[model samples]
Target chain A: MSYLKEKILKDGVVLDGNVLKVDSFLNHQIDPVVLKEISNEFIEYFKDKEITKVMTIEASGIAPAILVASHLNIPMLFAKKTEPSTLSNEDQFSTNVHSYTKNKTSRVLVSKQYLTPDDKVLIIDDFLANGEAALGLIDLVEQAKAEVVGVGICVEKSFQPGRAKIEDKGVDIFSICRIASLENNKITFVEDEH
Target chain B: MSYLKEKILKDGVVLDGNVLKVDSFLNHQIDPVVLKEISNEFIEYFKDKEITKVMTIEASGIAPAILVASHLNIPMLFAKKTEPSTLSNEDQFSTNVHSYTKNKTSRVLVSKQYLTPDDKVLIIDDFLANGEAALGLIDLVEQAKAEVVGVGICVEKSFQPGRAKIEDKGVDIFSICRIASLENNKITFVEDEH
Candidate 1:
């Protein structure tokens, strides 16, 4: 985690208290160098686990997931944000995800062909806030009867409830950069608890 | 391109006559191995060009753009699909794009700060169909007074008008797979002339 903890994305955007924005490395532009390191960090953190598949949501998460999955030599699954395909709901594993940033809720779908009861899933995402997207991914994993090995996140707002919510589900999390606060346009990282 | 012309995605999904679907490498799930090859192909084709940024539309193109950008050690910019941010339309280069797959037209926006007049951008994407997405991306690059070095596409339906459209804009294109026909659920690759 310290490897990424030392990194500053978008030169670390300065936003007022309680509003965190790290838009430079993702959403708008992604630095492959940082993302490459993020993938390696996730691989290093979750290397010991028997990760069968690396799962993530579409748009932002797909980039990191691809690097990690490729390095691990595992298939990367990204839940589609598009309208469910012609395949009935039974043929797909889906869940409702509410985005705190955009303030909207959309149904995310993953084909049953990809996720199954045999997968030891490692969920990855660009950022974690309120745990909405992560939870939706876990829901889809659960619906497939797959085992959730743990979740790998690039940036986590430790001040938020996302960590607790995922832990409540008995899933583990390894976040590279843990933000303790973003008040007064200053960035602070949570000291490693370990 | 012959190197990739031999690769078949999703075992070449069979659907009778003209309708082509490649949901395996991208959109739903992205095979890192294939994407890695695609990135190398792009690097090989455009290696001589001085590319400042690798640009692509969000949701699907982000994965390839990330890989290509990282391999080249350049920044990757993905146009956001979300509603334009508070950055007045004047400050953002916005365009209306119609997705034949989704059958809907929505605006895609790119911040003005990232794209600049001095940029030599290499546009990348997962597929090329009617060329609406490609054309929209080209428009955004042009709006910023940036030079479009070329377009790198993973899969292109050569039978479609996308190739003709992009070529008409005077932008070079390098597609790994050029499909000649998909009649009778059988896949055919366009024979290389050179």
Candidate 2:
């Protein structure tokens, strides 16, 4: 987590005193080496949970989810933002998520065949700001009758209500990098709280 | 490659005599073990190319591209389908791509910081049918003046014109599993070709 924290301090960009842009190595452009280490960190944090599948949302979270899934030797399922024409119209779980960035609401869905009641799911994502996407993923998992063991995030905005929302759901959330605030073009880390 | 070929034979679903769905292990739901093997196969095929970076589009391609980048010890850049507000509006390369599935054309963009003229990129993607996405990615690479050593695909429909289009640009294309035809729910692979 320290490595991730340091990487955030070094490469992460703070914009409008709130948004943290890690496009250089975390989101848009990925550093697979750092990503491997991040996934290993997640595995270390949740190794005892007996995770059956690692889940994430499409686009940004897929890369880290792949690393976590690969290291854990588990399958990864990403909830699609758009329903692909190829997917059958049978037995699917879905929920609507509002994106503050895109300023729109989109339905995220996963086929029931991928998730089952017998599976223990670990939800992973790139960023947890307002936690809408994470909540949507949790909804999909619940609809499939699977239990969510925990939520693993690469970066969390502590100033936002995302953490409180997920915590209110009584699900344990783990983030590698926790930001206290982004002010005056500077990033502050959430210290003494790992 | 044989493992992937066998996986396609075993789990791939042929639909509408044209669409081949390997969502069970490749796209929607990812098998990390198979993905690791597939990335290794790509590495073996392009080991001599001195790839500096691995590139792909968002959503599906990020998983395989991560494995390839990790195995090769390089960076991975995914062209974003929509430009995130967090990304700086400076020094970016953009291209328009038509998605057959979504039935729309969207602009894909990548920051210029990720790709450079000296970088040799290996483009990776989940499927190559019409090659529109691949061509768009190649355009992004070209805009940055980067060299595309090769394009790696998980599943290629040789029955389609994707291969010929990419080959016309004189870049090498490698596919783990090549489907000759998908007719009547039967998947036919291109034989005696690796």
Candidate 3:
């Protein structure tokens, strides 16, 4: 996590409206070397858990989730934001996710065949700001009668309501980098490692 | 390539509209073990090439690209289909891509900081039908002044104009599985070993 935090400090730009842009490496353009290390870190963190599937929401979270799943040698499923014509209507689970950045609520869905009662799912994402996406995945998992072992995130805004909302549902949250606050165009990290 | 062709014959479902859906192992739901094999296949194919980075488009392409990048111990960068809020205007190369499935054209962008002229990029994607997405990626790579070594595709529709179009541009294409045609709701492979 120190490596990630250091990388964030070195390249992450703090813009107006509390937006910490790590696009240089993390989300937009990925550094697969650093990304593999991050994936290994997640695998080491969840080494003991029985993870059946790694579930992530699309567009941004795919890279980290894929690496994590490959590192752990588990299958990873991404919930599609835009419904493809190839998808079948009979075997799908749908939920609503509100994006504060886009100021729109969109319905996200996953194929029901991917998730089942036998699954011990680990939900992963790039950022957990309001926890809306995480909640949506959890809903889909439950709909398939699967267990959400934990939620793994690359970055979490600790000052936001995301952590509290997820914790309220009795889910264990593990984040690589936690932001304490953003003040005066400067980014601050949470002091506690946990 | 044989493994992939065999996988398609065994697990791939031929849909109504010449669509072969491998969602069970490739895109929506990934089989990590199969993906590992795919990573090895890419490594074998591009073994002698000087690949500086593995570039891919977002969503489905991320998994195979990450797998190949990890196998090669190189960094991977994927193009963003939507404009991420964290990205800065100072560090991005953008291009237009038309989606056959969506019936719309959109601009895909990658942070310019991650790529450079010295980099030899291997473009990776899940499918290569009409070659629109692959061409979009090639455009972005060229815009960054980077050399595209070649393209790696999971599945290619040989009956379509994709391979010829990409090859006419002088870019070598390597497809794991090439389908000759899909007729009578049956999948027919042209040069597939399986």
DockQ leader: 2
For TM-score, candidate 1 versus 3, the one ahead is 3
Candidate 3 chain A, poorest ten consecutive residues by summed lDDT:
A28-37
Full-model lDDT for every candidate: 0.82, 0.89, 0.86
Runs in model 1 with CA error above 4 Å? A1-10, A84-88, B1-10, B84-88
Q: Write one digit per residue (lDDT tens) for candidate 2, span A1-194.
A: 47777788888877883778889999988887679878888999998999999999988899889888988899999999878777766867889999987789998899889999999999999999999999999999998889999999989988899999999999999988888888887888898665
TM-score attained by model 1: 0.93
Local accuracy of candidate 1 as per-residue lDDT tens digits, B1-194: 45445556445564544655456655577776777888888899999999999999988898788888988889999888785333456768899899776789989998888899999999999889899998999999999999999999988888889999999999999888888878767778888821
Clashes of each: 0, 0, 0
**On residues A140-180, what C-alpha lDDT tens digit does candidate 3 reach at each position?**
99999999999999999888899899999999889988999
Considering DockQ, which of the candidate structures 1 and 3 is the better prediction for this target? 3
Give me the candidate number with maximum TM-score. Answer: 2
Candidate ranking under lDDT, highest first, comes to: 2, 3, 1
Estimate the TM-score of every prediction.
Answer: 0.93, 0.97, 0.96
Candidate 2 per-residue C-alpha lDDT over B46-149 given as tens digits, one digit per residue, 9 for 90 to 100? 98998999999988999999888987778999999877887656868999999786779999899988899999999999999999999999999998898999
True contacts kept of 2: 0.96
- Clashes in model 3: which pairs? none
Q: Which is the leading candidate under lDDT?
A: 2
